[model samples]
Target chain A: MNCFKALLLLLLCTSLPAVEPVKLTDDGRMKFTPVFVDGDTRLTFVDFENPKVFRLKSMDWKTREVKVVHEAAPAPEFDPAYSIDGNYFSFLRTTGGLQVSLVIRNRKSNEEVVIAPEPGFSGYRTPAIAPDSSQMLFSFANNFGQDIFRIDMKGEGRTALTGTKGINIWPSYSPDGKKIVFTSTRDGNYELYEMKPDGSEIKRLTDSPYQDIRGQYSPDGKQIAFVSHRDGNAEIYLCNADGTSVRRVTNHEERDDYPTWHPDGNHLVYVAERDGSHDLYLLPLKD
Target chain B: MLNIGSFKTKTCSGIGRRSFLQMSGAIPFGLGMSGLGMVTADEVDHVVAKAKSIVFVFLWGAPSHLDTCDPKPNSNSDYRGPFGVIPTRTPGVHFTELLPKLAQRSDKYTLIRSHIQSAPGHPDGGTVALSGFEENPKPVKPNFGSIIARHRGFRGKLPPFFSIANGVVMDGGRRIEAYGGGEMGAVYDPFMVGASETGKVNIPALALMDDVNPLRITDRRQLLQQLDSVPRTLEKSKFRDWNRTYQQAYGLITDPTARQAFDLTQESVKTRQRYGQSVFGQSALLARRLVEAEVPYIQLNYSRHVEAITPGYEFGWDTHLYNFSLLQDQHCPIFDRAFSAFLDDIYARGLIDDTLIVCMGEFGRTPKINVRAARDHWPQCYFSMWAGAGLQTGRVIGESDKNGEHPITRPITPLMVGTTIAELAGVDSQARAEMRVLDGGRVINELL
Candidate 1:
């Protein structure tokens, strides 16, 4: 029976004619699991059987576009995070086990460039650009678990902003671009914390026994929509920036988190796992 | 060369005198002190080739080609070893499934399966594998890389020769002649890099940043040379002093190009991920960069940090008694991905035309499985590899028997390989003067 299944799977695949050199441009959505949009130019980050890549295009009103540019080979890039400003984006690349530097992509000009750390540089990953898009923040693992780091926008190098001994991740700067809300394991379980861009202030946003992470600030900088597993299963929760006004927006015993603000505070979108798979879902704000 | 921070053992005068004393002893006491051991030094000469550089990817801990490469699926499962082979771009040739990337580019390399060597132990295997000479009863010989290094130092600013991992490249202590510069001065020893246990390691002497301003490092070097006292590890042998002189050459650590060779960050994220997040993968990429910087020889060591040795290798590849059981689950995965990506990049970037890549273990495993369901060491016959550097590419050089034991076609020896390295390094092994180290050691001529 297993052999039959294997044979059928093989047949279905081989039954197709030889694959042509696919110069893909139109299949932008599926090209990346989470296709990132930037104006008329619809962009997608694809992870092939090989390396991950970010592909950019200038789409028509019909979304028809030409392949404007691509990063070098090993193929489709992964984990690309862009700044609030469309001018710059960053992604992680690995080819042949050597993890070198972070990448900053500019859509205005179709050029993919790397702000690579020199050989022997340590503890760096997942660079996120600030809203103003001048400075970037990322994580670094040392004898301590992981810390947050901010580097010059010009990519001169890196500077440690949060010099603590814990795993600090998803450091998102507020719309005002002054405060950074990130998740950390320092308070034991994962929880949200807000601090000045210099990493001075300390305000806890959520208290949970389970993991609550990927904290993002609202356009008004008053609230944070974050993912949590406080009530048995994973779900999204909203709370005041000062750890007040705790509210459970959606409850179905499913993981509904990774929420992003839509420039307007009235609507927020997030990833949801209803049955078993995770896809994007939106919820209207009560405000 | 500044063996500082180099770990060493307490002296108890175990066997031979300290290398330094040995050097002093080389002088006839009654005849008045002479120079460092000059046992009739000759300018080893040989035909030179345009292939001045070689990038040797030494697969350490002796990877099993039967299961990982040179697969014979048709034979009985026991004799076939294990891991099934896959189709490669090179027709009639197939690699194990672990190496999907390399399988597609098999035509880019030349595989020599029927390598016959005498050493079954690690050091012996390594010696025969690198120097292309058997550990003889008398004076030992230098490794092929060291031999070239002695010819002039690296053709570039970086250490002329460097080793990443052990592979067959190291001497199994009992036979230092294999990897170490035996009779030749220590100046020929390959400079080993990336010794730090943490993946976040500093190249010790090389600068990686484009804005490093180069001069800052030179200013530091001058201070260290003038202000600080550089102490040498006390060994009595002339080779020990030679090693000291070799360390002095590292003073060129001032060269920007040399440091840039070790700068992995300069390569893109896409390139790093393609290689996978493993030591062997990173090492292979660094090797490519070093070669691009014109370092003649580089060895990329598969790490043995003990943090992830067998199961994920953390970079260990010894698969003797636990060959099948451990390899499929642990070893081959990283090797397959990294090796494939490395070869792919080399060809994609057109680096293949200029670089000579030899990827092989010291010796093949026993054809028959042991009681433990693993293959033991069988140095009687094994495989070596050859590609690039003007030699013909795209095909296996020799064939093995049904049991994957002996060679059925053209047999290979150490001399041919030594001769080949000499040809690449522009040395003439056949030249009468070059034969000095051998006092006559065997030189593999066929490899050329």
Candidate 2:
């Protein structure tokens, strides 16, 4: 009887989802906007050098070794995304003041295309390249409200996909490029919404009274991962592509935000604050 | 730089010994020197010393009054923004949903909604906010903290005034000229200390030399032995005077009591967790510890810079772009958890009665949403939160118009703020007259 009971306990513990920290940043600087790259072996993210400087950094999950992706610059460079073929790279670079420009580079050709915002307090936020690398989508703020816009590889043929009265940001394309998921506050507070690549057939994904932001579609396009404050604190949550079968992934009292899906679709890399220190962590999803 | 002990140290303002001596000669050092018996609460005349310590929570980069504390829910969507309002502990008072924790704890403090400033930009506004005077005239006035520090003098090992931040607060690259002592000299400047989100305390002025391992700071004898080895450079008479100042500076790190006061490791895991784990949160906890140490004035800054979304910058309340998103995702959540924890901790420890807690920014943001769908700098109106030091709690002291554009009540200027803080901290009108500071300032009678 005792042997049988011990076996039951072992099976239960082994079946539980395992979460592992990618790196322990003890310097009190924040690491945010993690993106999986290099076939899931490496992750790229933004790191705060000081209170005034942010740089792009990449680290190997297996070796736990980190490297700076871009050399230090006066302005901050962040929100890095890579095309499916790894031939196209894109990120947002702050010009001056609050204005930011999206830069897209063809790694193979060594050519770049830059889309700078008009003058005044405006900038591109969270640029996500399409799976085919044909176009790049990002959010820009105007006098009325913020909306997502998409531009081709040559920074031409710009199209505004969202024109709501509130903020519509953090647009991410599904693996097949059939659907685009984003966060919007048009209905009231921030909530996740998914629409066609052409901004048609819009569907509200989550209806939480609180904020639900930074939505990213999984590699398989079967589920979406996002950060929601419905429980009074920011935590990671997972829901189906159709916005059903919602389940909480993290329940820490502190914040667990900025969820980015790994290439495997079975895991996520995110920024979590534990004991006042912010670091990246890898969380395995349970089926 | 003065090479005392084993390492070279600079003053918080980077003033050298000669400059220090020159300033000391100009001002009477008797009141500021150490070894004087503690000035008891009863010793102050006229105005009672209701508060023995003042924690000036400086929220740099003005926050939008409509989005956070002073909500205009009934206004148009453009003016009101996208946030919903919730009722606070004080009846008929509502704050935006971004500040749920603070709203719940409204009974613990008083909220003032009719603040106005002269300067529309950060640099000039910050100077006026800190010194109650503009930077246009030569010899800008001393910061409110410097005024109280000079009045209280030094009562213990810790400096009378402390600015808990990574460095002096700045807007972009321009440091606030009025951040430190103005005409009063650098000797009256705050002792600069940096506290990380994890509660590690760093004294920038006393940074160790590269050769010395920081872990060895705990060993006083070893540190002093290295200090003794430095070759004498000054003449015997001058060296004696320099040595006295050197010992006093090093004493801050060597003294056990002082070290304990700055050490966040002494706090329990639960207490640290309560404060949340952000730089501002940990700094707020450190400010509480300084209050316990009887430091006369502590200016705990939210961030050193004013810009929020700029690269290489910490999130200040300057929400020029992405105002609602940043507030929901970053600023509000961090502030709600950390500040609520601080208020609870201080009250639980029975320190509220003698600790004047004032939290506000240099100014408020624009009431109307801007072209970017975010708020811009608006010196016309803002708000402040005051608690402890015998303040009437659970009440709204002033009112703003329906649109929150201007004050419906009498406008509360920065000068009045300095006067009220000084008066509560035992620096009476007569004392202000003697120092020739806050000359025309008057206290906010409603707060009393």
Candidate closest to the true structure, highest TM-score? 2
Model 2 clash pairs are: A52-B312, A53-B312, A143-B371, A276-B277, B5-B227
Per-model lDDT: 0.55, 0.77
Question: Ten residues in a row with the worst lDDT in model 1 chain A?
Answer: A21-30
Q: How accurate is candidate 2 locally (lDDT)?
A: 0.77
How much TM-score does chain B earn in each model? Answer: 0.76, 0.84
Q: Per-residue error at A73 for model 1, in Å?
A: 42
Across A180-206, the per-residue lDDT of candidate 1 in tens digits comes to: 998775655467888888888767777
Best candidate, lDDT: 2
lDDT tens digits, residues B290-378, model 2?
99999999999988632235754434888888788778767887788888999998899999999999999988887777777788888
Please state what fraction of the native interface contacts candidate 1 reproduces: 0.00
Q: Model 1: per-residue lDDT, tens digit, B414-445?
A: 55566666666566544425546433443333
The alpha-carbon lDDT assigned to residue B6 of candidate 2 equals 12
In candidate 2, residue B188 scores what lDDT?
A: 72
Q: What is the interface RMSD of candidate 1, in Å?
A: 21.4
Candidate 2, superposed: residue stretches over 4 Å from native: A1-29, A71-75, A201-203, A244-247, B1-48, B85-87, B207-251, B305-315
Stretches of model 1 off by over 4 angstroms after superposition: A1-287, B1-48, B136-138, B166-177, B195-222, B225-227, B231-252, B303-315, B430-432, B435-448
**lDDT of each residue in A68-182, candidate 2, tens digit only:** 8877555878889888878788998888777788899998997988888898767888889899889889888885788898889888888899875677889999999999999
